[model samples]
Target: MAKWKLYWVESDGYEDCFVVAKNSRSARSVEANMNGFDISDATAIRVMDIPDIFEEKADKKFRDWSKIHAPQQANNPDLHEWPWYADKWLLEELGAQFRVIDNEEQILLRDIVYAKKPTGEWYTYSIGARAIYERNKDLPQYDNYDNEPRIDISKQLYTAMGLALTQCHEIEFLFSNSFVFAVSEKQKKKYKTFNDFFKGWEKKTLGGLFSAMQEAFDIDPEVKMALDLFLDMRNTLVHGITTTERYDINTDWGQKELLAFLDLFLSLCDPIKDIATSCFEVSIEIANTYLLKESDENIPIKSSNELLSLFINCFKLKSMN
Candidate 1:
């Protein structure tokens, strides 16, 4: 009994319509029944779940309760205008990569999920698209940005990526202070940032951090390289040194470039997000375990063993790798 909403437009731009149904397929069926044609004939049809909390971040029209059952509901707002729902779901379904840039007030998402269709079209559900909409919402050129985004999505993508990684590095430095070796009083005088504080302890470089991560977690070396490359890409983007040339993605050289980009992007994002999420989950688990440890008189295991077991189960998959 999950509610759903459908959005559709005529092939020739003659009409547009919306419908509510129990699920996606039924929405299509509803469209067919109204149009006097087979469901297969419906053009530009899309179906999305109308969850109960849709109004929190989305428009009211997206809820299935906005159905036109009476005259009062006839002039209800357009469900297609609902923000962020379709793009978020579509990107998620396409295996979009997300990086968390944690901060004191809130967490930010850095998405590097730019993939192309076989026909050389860029997928629009990306941080780049979201950025474009936010910056140019008042501009005439960006009126239909969600449906038809900027010609070069990669440009905005790299910019978003640069900022995302910069913030993520700051976040890492913030959370990693307790784990890093303590610096001597003399060496501590040289520390300006959290990164300096950590690096000062063992005279380590960024490469050292990568090496330690690889040894401890068996993460791939290529992932470290990709992280290094993001800094370079960020610099190029900020300095306006990024170059572009005409190249169809269907061409062999273009295909190679596309594949290489996707591989590197995913390599950098997937493992880092996994580790960060696991750290958050394990912290919560331990906080709960601490309460249980204090309350129970008949503790089967020591507190240290309980914490180890909690971390072990939390990262069982990583251990398997």
Candidate 2:
């Protein structure tokens, strides 16, 4: 048996991909064949040996489940027919998107490689730490007219700012869904009515959602404080950035201010991210609790009302920390 080795392959103008092959030559060949690039022009760096039993059982279980439940059409899947599966799919998709955005932000902050083009525009690229070092190692250092090194600080800050805002938006969406699940439980317990006050709640601002959540539950003070700080930073980036003349992207002083703002923004992201993570955890737990039977057998799916009790209970238990 040929032992598979992990390799990181990079080709010009193509997204880097990982391949499992017996050797570096095989890895390059695999990438070239997969991406329609010439093997001669591809660079393959051996990463490590592929673990034989990494998630083997889980992988087989998922494969079996997928074979049973896989949608027939790419876009026409009847996931909605199974509410539990639909919610599970949606949550997984959201988590994947969040991870991608978070990773892009980290790459921009750490592994970015950029240069000024002939057209006076900046070109920035990143392909993780190793690829970044490989590509940047041979580049000649250039300096500005004042003997200072030429650096695209503004572009980095601008990109980082955009990513930070995007992450905030994702967090808000997750928080909003969590609030709905929690509030739905409250309504069912108290009014015994299916009336949802938070319909079209996504249209509301994050501040409004925060207020509503506070009024609906005994939210942890630390969570509230973290969310308040996040909201303040998010609002400044969204609303105050254009009107505020102090933080200009065109000058060194303005760029410094922008960097400072971004630093603080990123610092606040950890706590907010923790809260979002808690929301996801509770939502998944609620789904598992109500959607699956104890014997791992499919039962008659209950109405959303029945599920709401556990949703709010899980939310309160997880969010209070």
Error of 1 at 81 (Å): 50
Which prediction has the highest TM-score against the true structure? 2
Which ranges in model 1 have alpha carbons more than 4 Å from their true place? Answer: 1-155, 167-171, 174-203, 214-271, 277-321
At residue 252, give the lDDT of candidate 1.
29
**How many clashes (backbone atoms < 3 Å, residues ≥3 apart in a chain or on different chains) does model 2 have?**
0
> What lDDT is reached at residue 163 by model 1?
53
Q: What is the TM-score of each candidate against the true structure?
A: 0.26, 0.41
Root-mean-square deviation (CA) per prediction: 19.2, 26.1
Clashing pairs in 2: none
Tens-digit lDDT string for candidate 2 (44-109): 765444444432433444455666677353234332221011122332222211111212321122
Which one is best on lDDT?
A: 2
Cand. 1 Cα-lDDT: 0.40
- Cα shift from native, residue 131, model 1 (Å): 20
